[model samples]
Target chain A: MVTKFRTTIAALAASTILATSAFAGELVINTDTSDPAPKAAFEQLIADFEAANPDITVKWNLFDHEGYKTSIRNFLTADAPDLANWYAGNRMLPYVNAGLFEDVSDVWEENGLNESLASAAGSMTIDGKKWGVPYTYYQWGVYYRKDIFEANGIEVPTNWDEFKAAGATLTEAGVTPITIGTKYLWTAGGVFDYLNLRTNGYDFHMALTKGEVEWTDPRVVDTMNNWKELIDAGFFLENHSSYSWQEALAPMVADDAAMYIMGNFAVAPLREAGLTDDQLGFFQFPVINPDVPLAEEAPTDTLHIPANASNKEDARKFLAFLATADVQTKINETLGQLPIHKDATVGDDKFLQAGYAMLSSTDGGIAQFFDRDAPAEMAKVGMEGFQEFMVKPDRLDAILARLEKTRQRVYK
Target chain B: MSASRASRFNQRSLAPVLFLAPAVLFFLFYVIFPIFQSIQISLYDWDGLGPKTYVGVDNYVELMDDEAFYTSLKNNVIWLVLYMLAIPAGLFIALFLNQTVFGMRLYKSLFFFPFVISQVVVGLVFTWFYDPSYGLLNVILGWFGMGPIAILGDETWVTYGIIFAGLWPQTAYCMILYITGLNAVDPEQIEAGRLDNAKGWKMLWYIILPQLKPATFIALVVTVIGALRSFDLVSIMTAGGPWGSSRVLAYYMYEKAFSEYGFRMGYGAAIAVVLFLIMMIYITFFLVKMYRDEKGL
Candidate 1:
């Protein structure tokens, strides 16, 4: 009886293996795009990729945005898919350093992405080698009410003095100069990035994020003082911490607030809230120090093949296809983001055109936003300190001291 | 014949053990093994995927100075103390509704509705209720010219705001438990108390209370566990935010492990071990009480 049972179990296992291997030629892709537009764009890309590659089948897995963050590490180590969607910069560094992500420099060379995807190459590269391919990125800048600026006879500011003058003019007209919401904490990080980028320049900000420079460095102090000047001018919306980024836009839509420093994703929401393109405008964050080169915050999204993937060859083919200007244009146009490939056709929307122009004109290199540039541990404490500083600028010394301690512990 | 009798004896002894094997194996693998694994993992420096380096007691040492840890610990205490209010409040509601009024069954179910919904939903509903500008709570306060208070944003009031949300469902749960317990109360015993003129508080204190001891014990156990495991509300409503002021141990452990802060597996396990030890103290006390009761019986 025992021999018969063992033989039967072996037969069942053999049949299961045979059944699974029947479809072994398929390539699996995992993505986290929970929003409707991005999800639709991803589905369209998948359909297109499948239509283009008739020999290989694609197995796609979709996950909600937050759930994917925790599940990615486990799946990468245990049951890695052919390709996974991830963010660029410090967010991808841990996986790259751990050897979980396959280096895709060959894909870059084969596709000649060096020239086509030049703007995004810096963010995707670590240790002088590119680990992933960037598909889309959006620009962050000062989005303002054009009608309000025109009505007040305020020209778009190009430097710190002019910026403050604009704020003063808006305040005199009984409008909030700048609207922000720090309840989720990352919005404050955006402001801090622009401030650091404009004050100390891009190199100093990179070094600061990588833990090479202390938070209490006088240069950082100078950045904080510049931010404090705006706070003391009573230029920002009062009780801004009570609102999320979406809620903070209410004042801007109501004409009570004049400008918001945010990402291009805010455009769709602005239009939904009854603001016309003629009523809105975009500008680069004004330069704080003429000596410091102008850098911009542009967080890019990337795709990578896991090291343990079974279909690495097919994954490479998919990535190369994704990097082409045609594929990128379709994806970005659907998702309403800037395509990484320089030759990709941009949307006819004015905002997209403005963002492309601003990015092309950036003198210094791009740095991912504060959270994406710093290690997550450091980013958490750093964003918290930024929020606290905004609320109580008098606690500058104490907050910086605490942040320095955290940086030492985290980076060590 | 003697050999056959010995085989039968052996089979009788082994039958019960064979029948119980699957459950015991499951408990060992799922519960016991993870506890020991977590204890082992706590002594290392690991980021979930990388090779672990033994860090001795460094994680614990770091946790000692961690202001966030202390804040979570203090909030846990506040949660425990305020969470006990659910029991009394539930009992009061249960007593008030224990009657033969018109549509009492409908009233009972309606009163218990909050407990039936998932905690995540309750959290979202309360988040809107406490919104600083347009929430119902503030709108009502506006009538008195009092509050446009940002409950979730203010550090001092954030923990209280979350606890109050947690209590809404927890109190309803306790009320349901007591209502079931009240159903089993002996009518003869109540009549005997009435003959002795045991009315109102006297009757409840002396007669009804002792009979409800079993229900009270269950309520205490669940309420304590619920308070310690208060993660969903904190995650959904405040995210332990306005500067980590509203964090409890469970949410803090999750934040350290899986949040954007990167996975510090060893540090996160250390936190879990500490929470487990704290919970074990209460479990031991309850077990001792249960053991004593069994012995007396």
Candidate 2:
């Protein structure tokens, strides 16, 4: 009787497994794009993908923005979906290393994505193989007040000396040179990325974040010293550690601050807060050393097929569809971000256009934001160090020592 | 088998055993097993995903050197000590409200409102109240021309600020508990105490205090647990910032295990084990005291 019962249960499980595999036409896509814009963008993209391939019936599962991070681990190995949206660079490293994510180099090769998605190709590749297809990205730069700059006769500060002079002028005029909220820690990272990228160059910055370079290296010290110069000059908004990135916008909105080192996403909020396009403007981060090429931070968002996916053919088709220029253009317009495809045009928004121009012309390189580029453990420890260093510049030596220790642990 | 032998397997002992079997299994599976499992996991080095490697106390060894652990331990100590203030505060409020007066029900409910509101909302409210530029705290300080203070941002003051927010709800809960206990106090004993010129402090000490022992015991148990379980306020208010100076053990464990940039399950388990050991001490003490009280009764 027990053997018969066991056989019956085994048969039931086998049948369910067979049923799931048999439904090849059903393609399940999971993504954490629950925000209004990204949700609408995916709604449009999925509708288009299904319309293009009518044989494929798409099943899209939208996850909450925060909860998806932890849930993705469970779903990947237990009940895998065909496609998942995630960030590029080291953020996807763990999954890649664990063999949970499928290699999509064939998709890149078949679709000629290497040339078109060139800017993001470097980030998407690990161990000389493409892991995913990048769909969208947004540029990070110094977003400043145009009216304040005009009033103070600041001509966008092309170099470090000019930047400092501009800041000095702003200070004399009783205006903050920069406003940032390091309360969440990543804002400090954005500042650090620009500083490090400028002071040590993009390749060096990437090497450091990847844990090849020591945190206490002389080049890193140069970056920190430059950051300390700004801190000593009192260029940052006071009490910024008390605010979130959104709360920090208040100073810029009220014209108390002139500039912010932020992503293109900040434009919409700034405009919503009553700053006209005429009043708000964007500029690339200024050059600190003439020898280093100009690098920009633009975090890429990609979609991948899980290694355990049942509908491999349909998933590949969906990825190819997502990589198309026209689709990228339309989705990015709705999402208010830049498309990965080289030929895709940015939206009509001034910030978007400016970001597109700056990124396309960048000779140095592009970096995924600090959190995405670094391992998770290192990122958390490093960002905390960055925030602490900003708030307490005297702790720089201690902070660097701690970050070095974290690097030693995380990489191993 | 003989009929007498078969009949000896009676319902008396079997019935009680059979009835409690399901509950015991559930307790073992859900409660007792997880405790051992967490302790076992604490010795391994694993991210939430992938194969776990047996590191054999390496996680604990690393935890010993972890500065965040030390900070969390210190904060937890502070939380434990300061959280005791809630018990006495609740008793005083309970005593104040125990009197018969006009429209007293409104006053009592109003005082109970903090406990009724969810902890997340309380955290958010307190977050805004401590906002450096434009919070109620800063506004009050500004009235005296002392200027703004970033309560949640300052590492030295952040844990205390969150603890105060936690205390608001905790004190109210203790007040409600005391109020319920107050209802069962013997009136004859109180009348005799009053006749013996035992009023105010003396009456409360000799007659009222001894009777409220059960309530105090429950209050002590709940408050101690609540202090150790403080995660919501810390999570919502500052997220263990500015730079993780506000992390208690529970929050630190959560940060290590589940935060966006964290997945060190082994480290998280180690932290959980430490917390569990601390809680075990309290639980064992409570059980002993409860057993003694039962024996005395």
Candidate 3:
């Protein structure tokens, strides 16, 4: 009895010491994972993290998707949470430059994330230092209707000419070749990104978005001319600007439209709208110029610790925990996206598998979408110009001039 | 005793100022102070995260060259002019529904229903109604062998389309005002005009209109303010889209400051200052007219 009591007491004392050694503080996290899948992913992630570290208590604040964009600016400068969610690439440049976010290169070095998250490392780096850890990303490509393609006798286009021919064939069949809603403007940006990436190569496209190349550069005009051909052929849905990205899905679902250049998230809604796997397929955005190497767009979502955070130690611990291959696998499973960790296994969902395969083979480069690659002001102006160009192809010169003027002002 | 009585008299004189101080201070703090604050902010360059840098009228200069600003300004003017139609339309509807009949209350409520609905709901309803593929508007047009006009999509018609949606609720609000005015209207004068052989249009023009002056005044003021501050509908329906053909000054300010890509607080403040200056002109005109009319009475 005496020996058993002594052993129990010793075990209790060791546990107490372990608990005390663990940073027992409230770690506040703010995130815009308000979408059902992402919300569930975060809920599970937080619960598991808490279970792993018994002494640490987490306080999570879920923010509205749209409102959080502006609210992050407010909270980061004052009354900041220990960690927050943000996007990768130039989108986080403003915060990084302002010193609102904590530099977390140490986390990357210690966790061997330099090798594990290598594909996204370039995007996370600014000034030769990693700013945040990208957790999940989804590929953007041409999501088309297999039934419509079959009906028109069109195969998946591998090059620019074939893509145009497919659109022409679909158009002849009285189906809108490409369905897009430029109402919110980012849909047009996606189309522009793919075209520019394919036409000018990823490096030139990056230079253009970074404001190093002038907007009126001949290469940009080449891209615009290519886009104009598609527009002139009436390849897009009529009155597309009147609808949102979701609303445009109606025509595609009803077989009035054939294809949409969109991200993998569209797969969910398309599935929900009753499109079977046999009816739907995704193809990489086709090559525009044979000279340019193929690149892909996969906008990444990332997490960061604020510079003003009180509990840096716990935040770093949580960052390491969140960056684990197992955690990433679980996250991407729920998020319907690709995981950043190299060893993270993706779900058997056909679209997820396809995205994983496509991204894996991409040797040229990966872009973080147009709006994310460019600064915010430039993105807004550039997308507006793209929408206008898509509608009135004749306005290309004027739009390019306006964009050039804006680039001068914005970059300055 | 004499000195004490003098002090009491002074206290009586000062009591009204003391009583008025709280409200005056609130007005200064909430309304007047913000106007100056916006003007001050307009002269600086601020992204809300970093320190503000004063650029001294540069934002205003930039606005001069901004085509989008011109577009918003032109749209605002269109809204102001087109919005005035609500008042006359409301008066006519009030005249039609003013008659005593069975179930008139139900009809009146039905007419007032649009105003009772929130602006967000109204925006959504109209957005669906104007939808190119399946909207009721297109359905009606089909029966007439007309076009499936994409009003919201066309840059030419986008502003007008948003104005039409805004007019629905404004018309209903004006109708309620006219209804209440018609209730308070002098039946004796209407009878006098009738006895003078003044028939429908003449009676409404001479007799009924004079009494509705107050209602017209209130309606005009509210409509103008509503037209100027049309941020909610623009935000909800199209988000000033179809390439920003429908943006107003208020919506432009929000886009500059609070939009996902926008945190240029100084530019937003400049826009707010411009909008406030425009509103002040009308408000001053209203105050002067009201004062003159009161003095005349």
Candidate 4:
């Protein structure tokens, strides 16, 4: 069945490419990154794709992160890209629900993508349909300065208490302990996710965001309480309200702050700041209470085709190409992210290697980041609630109550 | 003779209507049409795409119980009321600069500078100025033996801080308008009032005050609109943050329709309708006054 599906997708894309080329048609692709590696990767892909199948020129409308969101939405509702890179979780659900995205389930089955795909990526499916394809994903956790840990004679922590002690060790060294940028709000969400996942486990996080569980549940309260304890211990940087994540990265790299709980993308910036692989290391968020079921760090970021696409066959071809082991390995090596391809080879970046090991060996996947998992409206409200809790722990009940009200209005 | 007179009256009436056609068309298409569409959209449950469900008054009903919406609405009211202080403050400065002094023209131009720059840039500049550790305001405060305060981070003070930033330019705008009005301030009356011993505050109150009414009205109109339309500053400075304490209706509407969360366009339009209704109160009053004055009543 999978073989037949793959063959059908290949045939379909080939025909579309052939027909489109005969007419001098152009393809537009919208992407979120202009990073050197991805820019080069995309250009190479376009060059190769065009070389193999002449007559279809590709136009790249690349934007930075924030601009990409706005531009993509504007373009989709007006004139959309033939292929676009987007988040795969509930972030893409609205488009799917609106029938704005085309189902590429045939392409997924044909490419054998559904066979080994983890449920994390599989969660992108809505109403038993696939809207987009997985490109590259990375695990988010604490990227600690290994040298600092070594210099202070503190071992990397594997559990919650030891993590707190490690934080104390860094603090006693006059380090800010954990560097974050709450100004963007999502950084706070990253911390909150790590804490919540560690405390309440993956299923409950899903339950809470899906409105199946109350945000004021004892487990949820415990998550906030856990975060407050960290804050009370002076684990986070002071003046977090004023700094951005990139700006906060400076202190961490400077050894003034010992760790940053960030995603795999942060690896490149850390390297750019002159930190060597041997100098940095990763640890899964320490288990909270040790009684909670262990959940891996979040794996997210996907590439999908727009449903209103003009050349969906070519789009499917591209998704299959992206899923191939060879391309995945090459992209992974350059981008320093985890390849969704089961047999893809990883490169020598210690941080990437560590993240690869952690995510590959995890017991279960934590679908998407908090913001991506929840409905957009609910996530925004909930994230603000998280920030408010961080700002004033005493307001936890009020914040949860407010978010509960939003969930009722939104989900209903 | 009666037929010729009737033709003459028709031409007189038609000429003014022909002249007003373009402006009326523009206003209807751009202003009147969109407002009605927004109101209609607000009556539905839509996410900017797919099917729009007819939710009737459900959206408004939901909004009434929404603490976030109420918080935003209340904040907007506070902004509107506090933002009006700019008019009188600007008038005082204009009166200061209305005299002959050394390089008064240069001083006046410099004072008017903030009003000319874009609001986005103004928001950024003020954000830096209000930064707790490194901001200029705090640096000066530190020298005076005061400690740093997180103006944007503290929920209690953030709205007031943004309003202060907004006032800087608003006051300048009002000053320029007042200066224009003061230029035509009937100088002979000032001398007559002086002769009558109506000096200082009394002279200004009884004589000069009435003449500045036109400028005051315009300033009030602009100030009120500016306050209600204050999304750029809040978006830039705090993004309705430090616990969602700084949100006003405009920013709240934007957050609902766009941004990271789902695009709840119908709900967004509903919030926008509420904001519009509140602004309409002031807008109607201004229009009525303008209409009366137009008729020389």
- Decide which is better by DockQ, 2 or 4: 2
lDDT by residue for model 2 (B1-297), tens: 787665667666677898999999999987998898788878888776677888998998899999999999999999999999999999999999999999889999999999999999999999999999889999999989986888888888999999999999999999988998899999999999989999989999999989999899899999999999999999999999999999999999999987888888889999999999999999999999889888995
lDDT for each residue of candidate 1 in A48-118, tens digit (9 for 90 to 100): 99999998888888878877887687667656789999999999999999999999999999989988999
TM-score of chain A of each: 0.93, 0.93, 0.94, 0.90
> Residue A248 CA error for candidate 1 (Å)?
3.1
Which lDDT tens digits does candidate 4 get at residues B96-161?
A: 999999999999999999999988899999998987767898999999999688798888889999
- Per-residue lDDT over A1-412 for candidate 3, one digit per residue giving the tens place of the 0 to 100 score: 2243235544654453222122348888889999898999999999999999988999888888987887676667545788999999999999999999999999999999999999999999999999988899999999999998997789999999999999989888899999999899999999998999999989987999999999999999999899999999998889988988999999999999999999999999999999999999999999888988889999999999999888888999999998999999998898889999999999889999999999999977999989999999999999989998888899999999999999999999
For candidate 3, the share of real interface contacts preserved is 0.80
DockQ of candidate 1?
0.46
For model 2, residues A236-301, the per-residue Cα lDDT tens digits are: 988787899999999999989999999988988898899998999988899999999999999999
lDDT by residue (tens digit), candidate 1, B126-158: 988988867898999999999988898888999
| Candidate 4 per-residue C-alpha lDDT over A1-412 given as tens digits, one digit per residue, 9 for 90 to 100 | 2243235544654453222231226777778878887777777767767776676667776778776775565556555678888886778877777677788889888877886454444676888877777767888888888898999999889888898898898888898889887877888888888888888788887888788987767888888889999988989877777667887887888788888989988888888999987898888778876767667655566777776677777767777777777777877777777777787887777777887788777774555787888887788888888777776778888998888777887787
Query: Candidate 3 chain B, which ten residues in sequence have the lowest lDDT sum?
Result: B43-52
Task: Order the candidate numbers by TM-score, best to worst.
Answer: 2, 3, 1, 4
**Candidate 1 residue runs with Cα over 4 Å from true position:** A1-25, A169-174, B1-12, B192-197
What is the C-alpha local distance difference test score of each model? 0.90, 0.91, 0.91, 0.81
True contacts kept of 2: 0.73
Clashing pairs in 4: A6-A110, A101-A307, A102-A307, A376-B261, A376-B262
Q: What is the docking quality class of candidate 3? A: acceptable
